[model samples]
Target: MIKEKAKKKWDLTRKMLEITDDEYNGVTQEDANLRFIKTKLQIAVYYLRMLDEHNCEYEVPWNKEQFKWLLRKPAGDTKKQKAKDWCHQCCLIRDKACASWSYEEATA
Candidate 1:
């Protein structure tokens, strides 16, 4: 049973992740945001499907650090600085993916 909330969330995520026909009918896996969003939705759907299979009520963690709303960014940082830092970090979910983000995590 797909809940209204889950359906909406999945729809939104899918739209953000997929490239439109106008966007170069040919796609590349090198697009980081597109790749990440695809992987994230896969995990979300996997968990939801697992819940259904087990007849369990799956509670999405709306407070996970992986989600932008739950992210803790440095205070007083400018958009340019943040964008630079994000590039430097490459949005690596793995702790040791980059030294700069690793340093940020350590200090934060």
Candidate 2:
């Protein structure tokens, strides 16, 4: 289920742009274009970092391209606040689920 979501995202991101898998694998969510990556593990990290930045309530934008980690400040820096907030909320959900599903994670 999670993998399908990632593949869909990756396919969309790649539809208009091109990315190599290795480069895709290397970036953290801190990258401005982090949303562009389509892999489960990498995307998970990207969202987690977005949550952290949001939880800390940043004033600056920190957007990046996945492979090089090259970044640009988010435009208007307006959505940054909202994205950060949402990401944080998502993090809480993910964390809670992970904690409750220790049996599955432990085995993996």
TM-scores for every predicted model: 0.32, 0.34
In the range 3-88, model 1's lDDT, one tens digit per residue, is 55555646654455355453334354334333444444445454544344333443444323444431222212242343334333
Provide the overall lDDT of each model, using Cα atoms, as 2-decimal numbers: 0.40, 0.40
Pick the TM-score winner: 2
> Counting only residues 3 or more apart in sequence or on different chains, how many pairs clash (N, Cα, C under 3 Å) in candidate 1?
0
Q: Assess candidate 1 and give its TM-score to the true structure.
A: 0.32
Angstrom error at residue 25, model 2:
20
Model 2 residue runs over 4 Å out of place are 2-6, 9-74, 103-108
**In model 2, which range of ten residues has the least summed lDDT?**
67-76
Clashing pairs in 2: 29-46, 31-64, 32-63, 32-64
Candidate 2: Cα lDDT at 49: 43
